[model samples]
Target: MKKLFYFLFVLGIVSCSTSSDDTLENQQNPTDLEPNKAFVYYMESPKVSSLQPSWYYTFNYKNGRLVKMIGKFVKSENIWSPDNFYSDSFTTLSYHNNKIELKFSNDTYPTIVYTMENDKPKKAELYNQFNELVTVKTYTYESGKIKIYSKTYTLETYYTYYLDSNNNLIKSEKLEKSGGLDKALTTTTYSNFDNSKNPFKKLYLLNDNFYEKSLSNNNYRKINYTIQNLQNPEYLPEIGNAEWTYQYDLNGQIVLHHPL
Candidate 1:
C-alpha cells in the first residue's frame, strides 16, 4: 500500500564527523525523546497551516559511518487506511564505518558495485537487473560535504536542499527533465522557531490553504499553570497564563497532542 501522512522529522544532520573524545555528557542523539531533548518536525502548508509531529530518528555510531537508522511513527488516531500505509520502503546508506556492510537481496550477479574513498562514494558501476551495464554516477565533495557531480544515465532526476543560517533547511528543489519544461513543486516558508528562549514553543501553521486550518493548525493552544502557596510557590496569574499543555509519554514522546 502507498504511504500517506507519514510524519518525518530531520534535525541536525551534519556532514562532518567529530572526534570520539568530544562527546557531550548528556547529549541527545536523533533517537532520544527525553523532555530535555527531543525530535520535532512541522509539516506545513503553503498558506501557513501546519501539522507538526515530533518523531525520532536514530543512527548507529560505530566507526564514523551510519550503521543503522530506526525510529517509530505515532499519532493520536490511526491515520493509516486501506489505501495508505504508515511506512514505506526504508533505505539507508553508509560512509566510513566498515562493520555495517550493504547486502542486496540478490547478489548472484550484482548490478552495481559502488567504489568508496575516505568512506565517501567515488564511483558506481550501474547495471540492470539482467546484469547489463546501465549507467554510472560520480560524486564530488565541497569542504567535506558530498556533492553529486554527474549521473551518466539516460534519465536523471536530482533533488537538493538549501539551508538557512540556523542550519535549518529553508528550501528544497527537485530537478527533473521531462517532455519540455521543468516542473518545480516548491513549498515556501511557513513557521519560524526562536532558538534563544523557550525551545519547545507553540508552532503555528501560517496559511489555511495547504492545511485544514481550523482543525490542523489549532492543535496547539495556550494554557495556565499555578503553584499553590500552601505547598509550592505562590501562584502567579501572569506566569500561569503563558503556559501550554500537550499529551506526552513518560519518555517525553508526544501522544494525543492537541490544544486543550
Candidate 2:
C-alpha cells in the first residue's frame, strides 16, 4: 500500500484545507522562528570517531501552537542522556476552532484528530486507548489540490496532491483498493525551491483557529528535491533516488534537513 501512504503522509495524519484571514499574524517572534532544538546525526565507521548524534528534538510553543514535543537519544558525542530520556515519549497538542488534537504520552500511542470545513481540512480521526475509532481520514478539494481518503476496516488508501502556483506541494500520488480495483502504487515529484525558506511555515502559523488564508504564503516553498516512483520497482531501490539539504536560521527557520 505504498508503504501505507508513506506512513500516513509522513505522520501529519492526513487532512488539508485553506482559507482564512482577519489581518492574520498573531504574535510570532519567540526568537523569530521558534524551532527550539533538533539534532540527528549519523555516519559511523571507524575513522576519527566519525560524527554522532543519534536523535534529539525539543520544542514547545503555546500562542504559536506547537504545544509540546520532546525526544532524546544521543548518548555519546555531544551527549544527551537525562537517563536515556523518553519521558513517556512526549507529544501533546490540542486546539479547537479548526480542530486539532494530538496526544501521546504513550498510551500505546494513537490519538490524532483534525477537522475543518469550508476553510479546508475536513476530517481525520484515529483514536484508541479505549477511545475506540481506529481510522478515518477524508479530505477533498480539486483544482486547488489535495485528495486523501484513508479508511480502515482492513484497508483503503489513496492520496494525491499536486500544487504549484506557489501552493508548493508539487506532486504526489498513491492508491490502493484491491478487490474493488484502484491500484497504482506510488509517484512523487517535487523540485527545487527555496524562495525564502519554508519548513512547513509553522503549520500555518499557530492557531488563529489554525488559520490558513490560502495557506498564507502558500505553504512555505523550500523543497529541494524528492522523486519516488515505485510500483514494485524491486521493492524499494534505496528510495529510488533522493537528495535534499537545507539549513537556515537567521529567521528563515529550517535549521537543517540533510537527506542526501
TM-score of 1: 0.34
> Pick by lDDT: which candidate is best?
2
- What root-mean-square deviation over C-alphas does model 1 reach? 20.4
Backbone clash numbers for all candidates listed:
6, 4
Candidate 2 deviant stretches above 4 angstroms:
1-92, 95-100, 103-125, 128-131, 136-151, 158-173, 179-186, 199-201, 204-260
Candidate 1 clashes between residue pairs 3 or more apart in a chain or in different chains: 47-207, 48-205, 48-206, 48-207, 49-207, 219-259
TM per prediction: 0.34, 0.26
9-123 per-residue lDDT for model 1 (tens digits): 1222232234222232112133322222222232221111233443433334443323333332333343353221123212244332321123233333234455655533466
CA lDDT, candidate 1, residue 229: 33
The Cα local distance difference test for each model comes to 0.33, 0.52
